[model samples]
Structures are given as C-alpha cells and as structure tokens.
Target: MATTHADDPGRCPEPLSTPDDFMGGFCAFNFTSGPAAGSFCWDRQPDYSAYRESSFGHGILEVKNETYALWKWHRNQDLYQGAVGDEIYIVREPERCLLKSSIAAYF
Candidate 1:
C-alpha cells in the first residue's frame, strides 16, 4: 500500500509512520491461500518549491531459489521519460538484529 501527502507542514502535524503500522492488517494476506505474496509500501511528500521532488524508484526482492520480484515508482514530473528512483533488494534469511522493547511496559 502507498500514500502520498503534500509537503505542507500545516497539513501533516505528525511525522510519518513506518510500514510496520499496517502489519496487523497484513496478516489477512499472509493467511490467504495462493502463491506466496509479498507486500510493498511507500511514502512520497514533495516540496512544491523544489523541482527536485522525489522521483520514481524501483525495488527487487529475491525470495530465494534465485526467484526475484520488482517494483517501480515514477514521479508525476517525469511522466514522459518514466524516470526511476533508487533500486532496492530484499534478502530473507534467519538472522538476528538489535531490538528494543517498550520501556513503559516495565514501569
């Protein structure tokens, strides 16, 4: 899922939330029977004054066994050329990363 908001500070008082915010809603997709599905999320807020607004971008995710999937984004300004933004790849594996638990819960 994707959402684009204007860069006007008055319009959006809070910082943008990450994709994790939608995780609960995504569980339904995971349970559906079908070819394994992947999820993609994006946010775009362009400064009206600067012509150098966020442009198109693409992503490629490799789910293993050499299989790959790709996604792309194009800014309205580059409608003719179809310019793309930075590319990304997602590699899945059993790994551990530093995680923090809520401190408020312990109080």
Candidate 2:
C-alpha cells in the first residue's frame, strides 16, 4: 500500500508546477524527487514517432499546459496507473527544464 502526508519530510516545499486536468490536475515536483526519476514515460495511443521505441513499450506525452502533461503508458487498462498517476510537471530553473512527477499523486 502507498501512503502520503501533508507534512512529509520528503515532500517538496511547493509543487514544481500545477495545471488543470480531468483529475483536477495535480501538484508536480522535480524529477529527481520521485522513485521513477530520470526515466521515460512511454505510451502508445496518439503515438509520438520521434520518441517511439517499440510497439509494446512506448509512451506518449499529452501536454495539458505549460506546466503539466499526461504521460500514458502503452496499455489498455487505466492510463493513470503505475507511478505518479500518469501526470508530469515541467521544472525550470535549478533543474533547468526537467520533467518530473508529483509526490502527492505518486506516493
């Protein structure tokens, strides 16, 4: 099981970014802050040929706004499963444009 807190020590002071979406959007943090940091999010539908690696294991980025996007995996079931609820954030400065997940949604 997974659990999170309003005051978790590891939680970011503030989300790197937040956007409006179906899940009412979410709070995003630096990529290095999550367990799946530095990895690619692969999906199939609405394919992205430029980033496509294989048919079975590819991901797609559905940009929601300047600060958020949805990273869907190549699967038929729940698109928001796995990690970070299939949501991602854009981190500028210090991180310099790093795509990351939110602890609020992932943890």
Candidate 3:
C-alpha cells in the first residue's frame, strides 16, 4: 500500500474523502518486483507521458511532462493510511531489477 504524507514527520495523514471523485496534491504507487518473493519500492513519481495539440495537429511534449501527484490528506491519520501493508517485491540483484540494456540475438 502507498500513501501521501506531509513533509513533517510528526503527524498523521488524512482519510480518503472524495465526495465525487479525485483528491488534491497527492499521488503514490507501490512497486512490487524483483528476483525474490517480496521486494518492493514505493515510488513517489510514476512514469507518465505528456501530449498536446498545436497548429501541426496532435503531438507529444518532448520536454514538458504533466504527470505528478495530486492529492493531500489531513495530517492526522498516519496509522491507517501511512503503513505499508501486504508483501512487496523481493530483490536479489539490484542491477537486474531495472532493465538497462536491450535484448539482442540469443542462441
């Protein structure tokens, strides 16, 4: 589980109170991957793509990215939403966890 906390370390986070839909100033993602059984990382930033429309029609932003966190909870519910529950990815080798090279011809 992933949650958003305040910059301070002496407070709790608030609960989900979406009356209709969406939150403000908060975004989170739990990464569960590795060579082992329960290795994981809480990534505050996720890989995202940006797009825009100009006189040349639709196009992707090669420099600007709009992916970001967009939710904020009250600083008083850390126990319920702050703790990371369940199992995560188990990593044996740190280098192999993230692919850095492309696959070539294999025999």
Instruction: Output the number of the TM-score-best candidate.
Output: 1
Per-model TM values vs. the true structure: 0.24, 0.23, 0.15
lDDT for model 3, please: 0.31
Cα lDDT of candidate 2 equals 0.42
Ranked candidates, highest lDDT first:
2, 1, 3
Most lDDT-accurate candidate: 2
> In model 3, which runs have C-alpha deviations exceeding 4 angstroms?
1-5, 17-20, 23-107
* Candidate 1 lDDT by residue in tens digits, 2-94: 434433334332223323445652222231322222322112332343443333333344344543434455455455575664444544332
Q: Which portions of model 2 show Cα errors greater than 4 Å? A: 1-55, 76-107
Q: For candidate 3, lDDT tens digit of each residue in 1-107?
A: 34333322433233332122333543333334532123123222233523311221221223222433223222233455443333233324333433653544344
**Order of candidates by TM-score, top first?**
1, 2, 3
- Candidate lDDT values, in order: 0.37, 0.42, 0.31
Model 3 collision count: 17
Q: Measure candidate 2: CA RMSD.
A: 19.8
Clash count, predicted structure 1: 3
Q: What's every prediction's RMSD, in angstroms?
A: 15.0, 19.8, 19.1
Q: What's the count of clashing pairs in each model shown?
A: 3, 5, 17
